[model samples]
Target: MFNCNWGFMTGFGPGGGMGGFGFLFNLFIFGLLIFLAYKLIQRLSRPDGTRDREDSLEILKRKYANGEITTEEFSRMREILRS
Candidate 1:
């Protein structure tokens, strides 16, 4: 049996902090990629707000037709459009 004495450790490791720094750098790059993906999806989902607004109106109309909104409620909401 051999006794090994490569004792305690910090996250940054013995006299060299680069491993921890590299971990953080990779994490940052990963987060940036995720953010860019989200933005790309958002951009692809709705290239223009006007079309999105029209789609929302169609959904609202469907909801109204399905009696999700009562006549009075629909009338009141007609004065205020949502985006």
Candidate 2:
């Protein structure tokens, strides 16, 4: 007869079903999936050129408000940005 008590044969083995590293492997895969999903959602939320233009305009406005740029310079840049 075959040896049924061999650890690999049945679920009653020393480390149980999946062995020691199984939990860690599953956890890693779960984390990877979550990270990919988050990145996909972030990418899908923004339109291509629109997000960049908006971000650039916001930065320009902040700089003007902070007095880092002259009013003439701000106006010029704002006009350029709007065009």
Which candidate should be chosen as best, given lDDT against the real structure?
2
lDDT of 1 by residue, 29-81 (tens): 77999999999998899656768677777877888999999988776666566
Report the Cα lDDT for candidate 1.
0.69
Candidate 1, residue 40: Cα displacement in angstroms equals: 0.5
Clashing pairs counted in every model: 0, 0
Q: How does each model score on TM-score?
A: 0.39, 0.53
Error of 1 at 9 (Å): 21
Off by over 4 Å in 1: 1-17, 47-83
Best by TM-score: 2
Model 2 agreement with the true structure over 7-78: per-residue lDDT tens digits: 333333465567656556656777999999999999999777887788899999999999999999999998
Compute the lDDT for candidate 2. Answer: 0.78
